[model samples]
Target: MKEIESSNLFPDRLYLIYRVGRLAFSSGIFFLFLSLSSISKLPVAPSSLFILGIYVIVSVALLLFSKKPYTFEFLLDEAVIFTLVASNVLNYNFFSIFLIFPVFFSTIILGSISGTTSLIFGLFLHIIFFLQKHNEGIATGVQTVLNSTALIAMFVAGLKLERKLKSQAFYIKELEKEKERTEFYKRLYEISANMAHEIKNPLASIKGALELIKEGKQNERLLEIIFKETDRLDRIVKDFLHLSRPSSPIKTEIFLPEAFQEILQSLQHFGKNYKLDVEPIKFKTDARGFYSTIENIVRNAFQWADSKVEIHCHKNNHTLEIIVEDDGPGIPEEEREKIFEPFYSKNPNGSGLGLSIVNKFILENKGTVKVEKSKLGGARFVVRLPLSEEV
Candidate 1:
C-alpha cells in the first residue's frame, strides 16, 4: 500500500466520512416517511412514537458523527448493521432496498475483502428479517437477493476498472521521468559541444607557450604545476564528452569475485604511493556496471586517502555488499548527500563527476549506494548489488 502523506491524511478521511454520512442521512429521511406512512393506517399508539423517536435520535447522532475522521471500513460495517436492524423494526417492504445501495457503495470504495464482508453481513440480516415477515410474499425475498447479487457484480467490475486506471497512472509517471532525463542529457551535450569549441584555441595557445619555453628554462616546480592543472582540465573535458554521448548498450552477466579483483588491481596503480588494503569476498553482480562502479569509487578513495584505504566485500541474501573506506578526513555531513549530484564537489581540484558516475552505474544495475562515517575514521561508501538470477 502507498503510504498516505501527512498533508492528505485528515482531509481524505473526513471526505469519506462526510460522503457516507450524507448518504445515510438521505436514506434515513426516506425511511422516516415510509415508516410514518405504514403506521398511519394502524393505531397511533405510544409504542409507535417511541420507536420513531429512537430512529430520529440515531439518525441525528449518525449525521453528527459523519463529520469526524473515520475509516471506510468502520462506516461500512456500522451502516450495514444499523440498516439491517432498522429494516426489521420499520417492517416496510422498501426498507430492505436501502441496504443494497450501501452494499454496492462499500464494494466500490473498500476493496474486495471489506466490501465482501459488508455484503455478507447485510445479506444475513436481510435473510433473518424476511423469515420473520414471510407472509409478505416470496417475490420480495427473491428481488432482494437479486439486487444484492447485482451489487456484488458491480463491485468486481469497479475493482477491475480501478486497477486499470492505477496501472496507466504508473506508466505515465515513468514516461515523465524518462522525458526529464532525456532533456537533461540534451542540454549537457549542447553545453559540452560549446565548451569544447571555445576552449580549443586557448588550449593550443597554452601548449605552444609551454613548448617555446626551453626544456630547462622554466622553473621545474612551476612547470609541473602548470602541466598538472592542464591535465586536470583535459580530464574534465573528456568526462563531459563521455556523459553527453549516447550510452553504450549494456550486456550484463553475473561477474564473479575474480572480475572485481581485476578492477581493484587496475586501480591500485593510482594509489601505489598510498597504503591500500583490499579485502575480497565471493559475490555476484552485473559484470559491466559493477566493474565501472567499483573502479570509480576505489579511484576516488585513492585520491582522498593520506596513506591507507580499505575495501571489504560480503554477501547478504540475494545481494552482494561492498564497503570502500579511506583514512583521510571524511566528507562533511552536509556535503555527503550532495556529493553524488552531477558536477558537485567540495575539493577545489576534484572533477566532481566521479561519485556521480558511480551513482548512475549502481542505479542502472538495480543497486544502491550510501555514504557514512566509516569504522576506519573516514568516509565509507556502502554498495548493495542484487545477485544475478541468470547465473
Candidate 2:
C-alpha cells in the first residue's frame, strides 16, 4: 500500500483527488439506487429527476477528470460542492447528511482557505434549509450554531493531521540518510584500520633491513628483501586508495584476447602453465579498472594453482564474460561468500584485501564477480561486464 501511495502514476494532489473522486462516484451510485427504489411514490418528479441526471453525469465526469491533469484544487472542491447541491435538490432527510462529505474533503485535502470557503457555503445552504423547516425558535438557532462549531473543529483537526503526517515522513527520510552516512563512516574506519595493520609489518621489515645495512650487513639478499618490502608497502597503499575512491568506468574499444594476454604476460613467472582462451572481439570498458580486476584475480589464482591457471573470455550479446580457474584445492563452499569481504582470509600471509579490491573495481565498472568450485579443482572467479555501445 505504501508503494502504491508513492507511485508516480498520478501527481500527489491528483492522486488524492483521484481517490476521493472514486469514493464520490461510488457514493453517488449508491444514492442513485436508493432514489430509484422510491421512484414509484415520486414518479417523474422534475427536480428529483434533474438532480439524479446531474449526479450521474458528474460522477462519471469525476472518474474521467481524474485521467486528465485535474491539478487545480478548486476543480475538485467544486465537484464536491456540486455533490452537496445534488443532495440538497434531492430533498431526502437522509441525503442532507451527505453535505458533510464536501466539507470533510475540501477542508482535509484543499487546506484552510478552501476549507473555510466550503464551510461558509455549507452554512449558507444549511441556513436556507433550516429557515424553510422551522420558525424563528431559539432551539433551531442553537442547533445550527452547534453544527457549525463541530464542522469548524473537524476542519482544524484534519489540517493538523495532514501536517503531522508530512512531518513524520520527512523525519523518517532524514533518519534514513543519517543512518547511511553513519554506516559509511564506520566502514571507512574499518578499512583504514586494516590498511594500517597490513602496511605496518612491511614498513617494520624495511626498517629492520636498513638497520642491518647500517650495521655493516651489506649482503645482496638483505638489500633485495628491503626493496621487496618497500614494494609491498606501496602496493598496499595503492590498493587501499583504489578500493576507497574508485573512478567511473570510461569504456573504450579494446580487443578481449589482447587485454587478457597482457595481464597474463605480467604474471608469467607466477605459474608455469598460464593458458588463455579468449574470443577475438572488440570490448568496451575502463582499461585501468579492467586490468586491475583481472590482475588481482589471476595473481591469487596463480598463488593457489599447482601447475596450471586458465583464463577464458567470451562475449555473448551485450555481456562480456571472463572466467579464471586454477588447478589447486578448491575453496570450501562455506567460505566462498566471505572471500570477497575485506580482511577475511584463511591464508596467514594473505592481506585478504586482493579479492575485496577486485570486487570493488568490478562493481564500479558495473560488473559482478563470483567465486565457485571450478572444473580445474580450485576456486573459479567469474566476471560479467555489460558491453557498452558499439565503438
Candidate 3:
C-alpha cells in the first residue's frame, strides 16, 4: 500500500532531467556568447548581457520550485525561449535549438494540453520573428521549420514514453500480488496434505489400541500402547507448531560449549552413544532455535547411526560448523536434498519432520545445513552458523 514515487511518473526525476537540460543549454549559450565576442574581436554585446540578466531571473525562479512547478512557470520558460529566438533573428543568428527543451518538460510534467499550447504559441512567434526577415536567406526559413518539427517529435515521444512506463509499472505491481496469492494457496495445500498424512497413522494406532483394550478388558500393556500412541500424536502436533511459529529467531547470547553440553545431556534420553567435540566459542543467536537445530540433527543421526554418533564442532572464520555423522548406512546423494522435505522419512515409523525443522532453524539463523559423505564413511550433516567474524 505504500505510494511509489515512480508510480507518479517520477516527478522528482522530471525535476532532475529539466534542471540538467537547462544547465546544458545555458552552458551552450555561454560558450556561444564567448565565441561571438572572440569572432568579432570586440566586447560582449549589450543585447547578450541583457538576455543573460533575464536568463538569470528566469532560471532562479524555475530552479526554486523545480519539484512542483506551476503551469504558468513552464509558460514563462517557453516565453523566454521565444524571446531568445526573436533576438537570434534580429541579430541574424539561429538559436531556435533552445525551444525544444521547454516543450519536452511541459509535455512530460504539465500534460499534453499545456505542452500543445506552448508549441502553437512558439510556432506563431516563429513566423512573425523569422519570416519577416525572409529577405536574409531561404535557409533560415527551412531551419526554423525543421526546429519546429523536431520540437513536435520530442513532445510526442515524451508523451508515449511516459504512458509506456506508467503502464508497465502498474502491470508489474499486479503481477507481484498475483504471484503472492498463488504462493499462499500452494503452501496452504502442502501443509494440509502433510498434516493429514502424518496424523492418520497415530490416530489409527490409538483407536486400535483402545478397541483391543475395550474388548479384552483393561490391561497394563494395552494402556501403555494407548499412552505411547497418544505421545506420538503429541509429538506430531508439537512439530507442526514448531513449523508454524514465528520465523524470526528469538536471539540471545549463548556459549557454544555450555549450550551443547546441556543439549547432549538432555539427549541422553535417546539411549544412543553420541560423542561431542565442541569449542569454547561464544556468540549471540536464538538459544532455543539453536538447541532445536542441534537436537533434531543429532536425533536424526542417532536414528540411522549404527554403533555411535560423532559430533565435531569448531570455528571456521566467522562461522561455527557443527558436524554430526554416523557409522550407519549413509544417505545416497540423490535422496539427500529430498530428505529435508516435510514427511519425507525413509524410516517406516518416522514422521519425517526432524530434518525439515533442522533446515528451517538453520535458515532462520542465516546459516546453512548441508549433507555430505563423512570421513567416518557415513552420512555427515554439517551445520554452519554465521558468527559475523566475532571471536
Give me the candidate number with maximum TM-score: 2
RMSD of each: 11.2, 6.6, 9.1
**TM per candidate:** 0.52, 0.64, 0.61
Positional deviation of residue 105's Cα in model 3 after best superposition, in angstroms: 15
Predicted model with the maximum lDDT: 3
What is the lDDT, from 0 to 100, of the residue 92 in candidate 2? 26
lDDT of 1 at 250: 52
CA lDDT of each prediction against the hidden true structure = 0.62, 0.70, 0.75
Q: Which ten residues in a row have the lowest lDDT in candidate 1?
A: 1-10
Which digits, one per residue and each the tens of the lDDT, describe model 1 over residues 123-232?
A: 67666666765777887678667755665665576567446545665666666678778988996886566456445644675576577565655666656756776887
TM-score winner between 1 and 3, please give it: 3
Candidates 2 and 3 compared: the better one by TM-score is 2
Segments of candidate 3 deviating more than 4 angstroms: 1-136, 217-221, 247-251, 268-275, 332-337, 388-391
Q: Give the TM-score of candidate 1.
A: 0.52
